[model samples]
Target: MPLLNSPRRMSHSLRALAWLLRYPDDEMRAALPALSEALHDERALIAGRLVELDDLIDRLAHAPALRAESDYVELFDRGRRTALHLFEHVHGDSRERGQAMVDLAQTYERAGLLLAPGELPDYLPVVLEFASTQPQAEAREFLRETAHIVRALFTALLERRSAYASVAAAVLDLAGERCDKVTLPEEPSLDESWAEPEAFGGCSTQGQSRPGQPQPIRVVRPQPAATRSAA
Candidate 1:
């Protein structure tokens, strides 16, 4: 009943899940064999959860790459319910989200993991990648702290009847928790209750400065003379 306690095995499992959660590009299709092998290596550590992930991986591995890519986009990109960014479940687009991102980025930096530009710190794949570098106890504690978010995502995926739900379920299993009693976010269907409108009710001009409201300043770094010439 203890979760995967072996650091190396846990790392392999986390990395495998992380890889699966990423955009399903041709590169991902090509890596399926290696990912399957890694998952197999950690099979005993993951126990029964391996079956779900293995089946999902096998399906993706053999499917047309474009189809798999489309499925990934539909499940993850188009809906907030199954969004892979963890903080979206927590802080959303609020100022707290910005601070949490900064904190998480600093944590990764402390562990010698620097994220690429445009990569958010709370992305589930990025979080797993960071966990893969940690010691077993540390990684387990980290997952435990984020287990609520994982449980919420698991529930959302299950509601959507997604095979990728297995990945979230596996993370909860490893965290030694059940998905019960978690008050999940009310994620309405985007096509119905959550559609974007053409314009706001109050705002008329797109970028006009309003009285008493501070306008955001754009900060542009100076480019090298050579780069400037090319631009």
Candidate 2:
């Protein structure tokens, strides 16, 4: 809602944003701006979507009883898109964004619809790192990957709804299972302390022991005296 300019508005926005922040599907992302606009202008696309959504809700009322394919599919598709769009929209600063994605994906699965596995993508962290760096090329590539993933997910749903459950499960298993074993360094004794060689002014020399190694010994050398000239 207009980004919460007033204290009251801000409070309202924060609460609403908190709720919206939890969704991360394409529809939610697409719909949020419209939703906000609708709140302001009343004649916004958001109002239109909301009206459509209401109609869908009406269809849902009889669901599995009346069982109209077109009505149900339309409602389901709109709901799905709205969920996704909201997730994407709040994702910018919403702490609940990731959790929302997980919940939304699971919700679809629970409803007997095949959907993508909800495990956070590995590329997500990489893209976040790239975003923090703000490199133009990296940002563009990250956005591209995000769009591809979104498209792939929807395509899977629309084309292979029947195959979705199995595929989503597989994807989740692969994403959640750890493939690499983590090797932890042995803990050091309290008596153990790091030391360095004085020969190199307490710095490591070439081919010295690697990190986590105890310090090396320093060698002592005697100073040479100037020689007196012999007559």
TM-scores vs. true structure, each candidate: 0.79, 0.20
lDDT of 2 by residue, 1-231 (tens): 211111111222222222232232444344455434433443211233334433433333333433444432443344322223434423522346667666645644554544335434222322232232333333333344344333433344434342222222222221222112122233333243233346654344323654456666789775555433331
Q: Can you give the lDDT of residue 98 in candidate 1?
A: 88
User: What value of lDDT does candidate 1 attain over all alpha carbons?
Assistant: 0.79
Which candidate tops lDDT? Answer: 1
On residues 1-231, what C-alpha lDDT tens digit does candidate 1 reach at each position?
A: 445453345788888889999898988878988987888887634556777888889889888888988889888887776889988887766567889999999999999889999999999999988988898778878888899888888888888888888889877766666645356657767785454534543233223445445556599999999999999
Q: What is candidate 1's CA lDDT for residue 116?
A: 95
What TM-score does prediction 1 earn? Answer: 0.79
